[model samples]
Target: MPAALRITLTTQEHQTLKELEVAECVPRRTKQRATALRLNAKGGKVKAIADYLGWAQSTVRQTIHRWNHHGLAGLWEAKGRGRKPSWTSQDWEALEQWLQEPRSISSRQLSQRWAKQRQVFVGAEQVRRILKKKWRWKRFRKKPPVPKNPELKAAKKRDLQTLKLWAQEDLITLLYLDESGCCSESPLYYGYSPIGQQKSISQRSRKGRRVNIMGVWEQDNRFEYTLKVGTYNANSYLRFMEWQAQKAMKRLFETGKPTVIIHSGRFNPSCQGS
Candidate 1:
């Protein structure tokens, strides 16, 4: 068994609690908490206080402890305390904007971004809980845009069917190619830059120096890449394809398996220039 806790109160504190216990205007829960604390202060045991107030023993002990720790303010409910709100209206608005499509940033990324933006620390789980409970945000697959021309749409469906046949026959291995680049003055930077802090990535501005990367990936854990400076062009794309082909062939030859490389990417009249 543990020693019984004895709460000692000052003359003013005892009197204040006594008044609150019977005050009609005070909320019922507040009165109960006040009475519980008062009984404890008068040298009542935890069980005695709980029985007298019709509250749990744990509740009685917690009430007295809160009163001691926070004085009068602790006796009353504090705004935004306990359990916590999902998020403020402002936070919800910011979240909506952050989750706008084509930017496939995950919940973890948004949580980290918000912490940096707000200068307050929070976890990814917290972000997920709010999104799920409040907004009911769920994963939705992004589908490719349908072509307005019926002929083009049907042609794509036919090509897809042919590719499915090839896949079933093991005649081709589908590999996806993607490329991207970044440069300063991109104007997409978001942050909570503190005052008097240097923000530039480099000591001096290198605004026009562009970086280019091309990657090839497929199922079965096969992948390769080409990275260089300058713009993505027809020559650059062809060279990347050739490099990936040689690597893929050498690997497959060692394994005594042969596969035809089938590249996947959109061909647009507009990208007649990427």
Candidate 2:
């Protein structure tokens, strides 16, 4: 068996102990537990009190030491731990304002500006975090426009509305017909470029010419017909429409009457100089 030791608390210290035990705040609970163990028969050894209270001996000893040194206020949470913050709250506010300005500044440029204005040197990652958390900034990429022409915008909107109406009415005979040209010898541009050398150079295959492709889509199904004619004008477009109309008539004759929607490039009467 180990030697037994007795511990006793002064009247004033005992009163302080009781006050902590009944205190409503959470911080007081830790202090109370420490005090209670110290006043017990184990003789207030740092390790003994810490073991009884299920805390680190250092922590138990520190609490008593702090209480003795600085009184109750020292038991409160500290302002911060480790090294002090290099940037003040005011510095963060200024950084946020600078970011909000309409200036195309890169991360490096922004970091330099922050270091100059706030007198605090920070890395790109730290700046990014502060911007995101405080200013709600995020990384974003630009998207290309789907339709560049104003007239095409109106036309596409009209086409979509027409298709939606046809679908809602259960019109199975509706079709979307249009034509596009593809150059067989056209070279492909795989990547994107912001600026600099190589401008106005056409990337097209040397041997092949552009081929016009007339296509139609209906209810998620598509049909395409290609024209091998040398030069295409208004006459060729009408002729293509006529051929499609004849095919539609033949199909209707075999089956029943079906709603046929015909769409084409704008028609010009003077294409053949008629």
lDDT of 1 by residue, 33-144 (tens): 8777777767788998888877788887788778768878877887765675545777767766776534445668888877777543557887765555434333333333
Off by over 4 Å in 2: 1-60, 63-90, 101-110, 116-118, 124-163, 166-217, 223-274
**TM-score of candidate 1 versus the correct structure, residues matched by position:** 0.32
Tens digits of lDDT, candidate 2, 148-240: 588987997897788677656765367777655666553333221222322122222235456666666666666657565343557776787
Minimal lDDT window, size 10, model 1: 196-205
Among all windows of ten consecutive residues in candidate 2, which has the lowest summed lDDT?
Answer: 190-199
The lDDT values for all models are 0.64, 0.58
Candidate 2 structure lDDT: 0.58
At residue 262, candidate 1 shows an lDDT of: 47
Error of 1 at 102 (Å): 19
